[model samples]
Target: MPEARAPVHVDGEVVASKRIGGYRHLTLTAPGVPERFRAGNFVAVSVAGHVTRRTLWVHRVRASSAFGPTLDVVVEARGSGTAWLTAQPVGAKVAITGPLGRAFALPKEAVSCLLVGEGYAAAPLFPLAERLRERGCAVSLVVSAPDEARLLSALEARRSARSVTVLTADGSVGQRGTVGDHVDDLVRRSEADVVYAAGPSHVLRAAAGAAERVGAWSQVAVETSMPCGTGLCHGCPLPVVGEDGVDRVVRACTEGPVVRGDRVRWDDL
Candidate 1:
């Protein structure tokens, strides 16, 4: 967990909700709280009891000096949990548990960092890019979308990036292909020392393949459905390589939702 942590009782009142291409970005205002929320860390939200509070990562953390923490969560609206969140009005007070989980381990020897994401997986990466850039790492973002509007919006937001690339299955974005196509090209041409991926399982798998092929250090953030944010629930467990070269299940809540790419058997997931 993050060390500079203090929980102030707060509610996320929906400030703005809009659909951009294939995904939805919702902004919430949680007053009087220090906005130390980072990219890899997530917030647990409570809706009706029928649906358990799901942990959603911070896509962007913006807080006005006048107000408190303003959080933006992006969801694809694929399930009941996200659907309920999307249906909420602008002033709804949603119970939120926050700023949990470990951070991305950036390499000191890295030349350039490459981030690859797709769909709703783009959330945590927005803050991550800024953090990496602040650390003096050359940061590049490659997000995939099905339409041009979403692709362009993401690209425009990171206009200050050393390089911004977009890929789409449809020919509507920068490249008419999956992010893997561009990732392959970037790794080869840019000679990036570290690669990070967050998105669909298949997308991560493809990135892992590319990273392994090039001998670059790769890490992936795995999105798991969890019953409890704490590890006791054992709901979000993934098979990880043990010290004995065997497989052992580890809880995503505690051990990690982020793990070394090579340690994960991408094909099994």
Candidate 2:
């Protein structure tokens, strides 16, 4: 495994911003950040006139654009902080600190993999899928949302993943059901040797359980809130069993954001 580079605080310029589905997709020129970016990494952006920094998934990285190296982020307008991020226009300058957190570990050898995601949180999985395909792994992706408008990259998944499956509660785009209803089938059909997932806690739990049932390894990118992305505040606590079989609390932003699904104390969290 390559060593992770140190995170840098940079003032990124928003080169492009677009509204896609229920999320805002922003492409920014983050000079130092993009080169170090890996799948499952996130950025902490300074919210205008706020003490808190809103963390967002670093959706993908563009190695060479007209503006130089850049990274993409998918922002959902939920709270005031996120709303501020989405409201930024083209050429807007925003403070960005990344690439933070441990990234998903790719298999050392070619193997079958399953990636599951929900809503806009699916951002990180796209890059991961690409990396897996490069390693000659059979990549299968599953994206879900409540409606068609919330689905992310259903069409693009066909181009990247060897197989694609979509689920929506309203049957707006694909099969009618929730992740809990279809994840097991997705796991079995993919014949996955490894499973990776991102979304809400419930969705991660479901994916983890399904993988375990089939005796496959599982890794999940947790969507926990962070007050300080660099682990200063120690605000986001994640419960997990240490290698010594002892329970311990770790900072999600530094210690994880991505962790072994089997190691997490799901019920405690």
lDDT of each: 0.72, 0.91
Give the per-residue lDDT digits (tens) of candidate 2, residues 20-68: 8898999998779988988988889999888979998977799998999
Span of ten consecutive residues with least summed lDDT in model 1: 1-10
Score candidate 2 by lDDT.
0.91
Off by over 4 Å in 1: 1-10, 31-34, 149-152
Every model's TM-score: 0.88, 0.98
Cα lDDT tens digits for candidate 1, 78-197: 688778877888777887766655557766653688888776766777777787887888887777876675552465447535777778889875788887666788777657778888
Which residue ranges in model 2 land beyond 4 Å of their true spot? 1-3
**Superposing every Cα of model 1 onto the true structure, what RMSD results?**
2.6
